[model samples]
Target: MSRRLEEILSNPEMQYLINNANNIENIQKYLPILSELAKKVKKHNTWFIEGLARCRVPYKDIEKYIDLDEILIDNCSIVGNIEIIRQLRNQKQDYQDYYVSSVIDIVCKTSEKTLEQTNKIEEYLTEKKYKYRFLPPDIYVIEFKSPNIKIPNQFGVYRYIDTEIEKQNLRIYFLIAAENNIIIRRNSIIEVVYIENFALFSLLFKFYRYTEKDKKDLEKYEKSREGLEKIIDKGFHEKDLEKIMKIFGKEERDKIMKKIKSYVDSHPDTIYKKLLELNIWFYRAY
Candidate 1:
């Protein structure tokens, strides 16, 4: 096997996905496409290529195999649950990088956790290499409101503490891409997860390692997998796209366009999938 192919398939999570085939048809349907991608476009996008392997079947490829929304709506037991799942799936339409939802949504829906609190929240954020910015208790009042720390020209969050009341005391604000500013006075933010120009697929490798030794214990393995499915469903954020644009580094239009064209030419199917799904033209300005 080619080294790239070997690298992609050697992943224990990918192997588990293959072994736990919901049906032979899912495997028969998407494996060849993944194989072709592993063999052909391996060099251009190691991150995404590996992601394809981690996901086993990218989102669109899963559609080629099964209609997940329809299956849930048809087969689910409760009416309220079906609506909730439908809404959840709709919210995740743009972020559906892979076929994870269909396989794991059942496990997710049964959990008592809210949509925001997926199990092992800290672990996944850690895998993404997020830098946690914890403010001192009076951080917002002293920083943003009072100007103690000079804010950098980058993305970050700032807040103010309202000691006037016992509850609802924190007021949160954010600087997006170091320019667009926002403030949230009502809702409390548990924490901020931030990673710079990070590839979404990298999480899969970490997830794989987390689940590698649990094959003998089916329940633990499936629970971990369910948590991962929640993370995947959150998908890549709009801010992440801005970060992704920096992949090739900043340069003149002609140079950037050339690199993008080369990428699109070399990885037609993958690029096409991204363009169609995300409505992003990574090749050129126009």
Candidate 2:
């Protein structure tokens, strides 16, 4: 039993074991002997808050593989309600290390998607007997899989200096379990139609490999802007607009910029169209 517990403790993701104990007092009541497990960590490196998934681990052995300072996880949960817990580090070399967990609410997309193959993945994980015990109950639960996708190295997640705006990399995390807990683990990459990362050329390469685009729509318009913007009349942010205009020495490009701005001011939600409009000024993620 001690060997299993030690093995569980040595897991890289086990810093928040006891704190994730469904009910700390209740867990302690049943696990009266857990207190004597011997403190491995000089201080707390990871903060596991209540109602959040946590992996129980021996902080002593695994510190070599990971860094608590860089933050192993910001907040990882499988049961919906996306409030996340963060890892905290103390500056002192004294008092061993004590970590107290805290919670905060922030708005971010959880990559909610309706995927068909999702059930195939979830069902596979459930039947794998991957179950382990944190206390008596199962610690980790497979919430659901993200869309059936893989980040193709070629997805256009790049950009050049010619671009007016830096391309964004569409990064995401996968929820996973280890040592009987729903810890956030890097699983497969999120396969997206349009990548935000600045590797457009790479993505283009992948596009050819997948060359199985018999059914894939390439000419469809991309999702346009769904955001609000500052309204301007015949006048506008001349300096800012000028900066954009300077990118293209051609007057034709500047003329197109004006047309794009007019479209943006009117539609306010045609970001993709606006992007296309500024093809000269805008950059591709390469």
Q: For each candidate, what TM-score against the reference?
A: 0.19, 0.17
lDDT of 2 at 62: 24
Q: Which candidate is the best by lDDT?
A: 1
User: Tens-digit lDDT track for model 1 on 73-151?
Assistant: 2112212112223233444453244223222222121112211122232233345343333223222210122212211
Colliding residue pairs in candidate 1: 140-159
Q: What is the C-alpha RMSD of each candidate to the true structure, in Å?
A: 23.4, 23.7
- C-alpha local distance difference test of each model: 0.29, 0.25
**N/CA/C clash count, model 2:** 30
lDDT of 2: 0.25
Candidate 2 lDDT, 1-286, residue by residue in tens: 3354455454543324433432122222322223222222112122222333333222222222223223223222221111100111122222122221111111111212211122322343245322222122222221212222111111111110110111221111222221111122223222112111112212122222333331121111111112111111112233434433343345545444555454446555553243443353333211
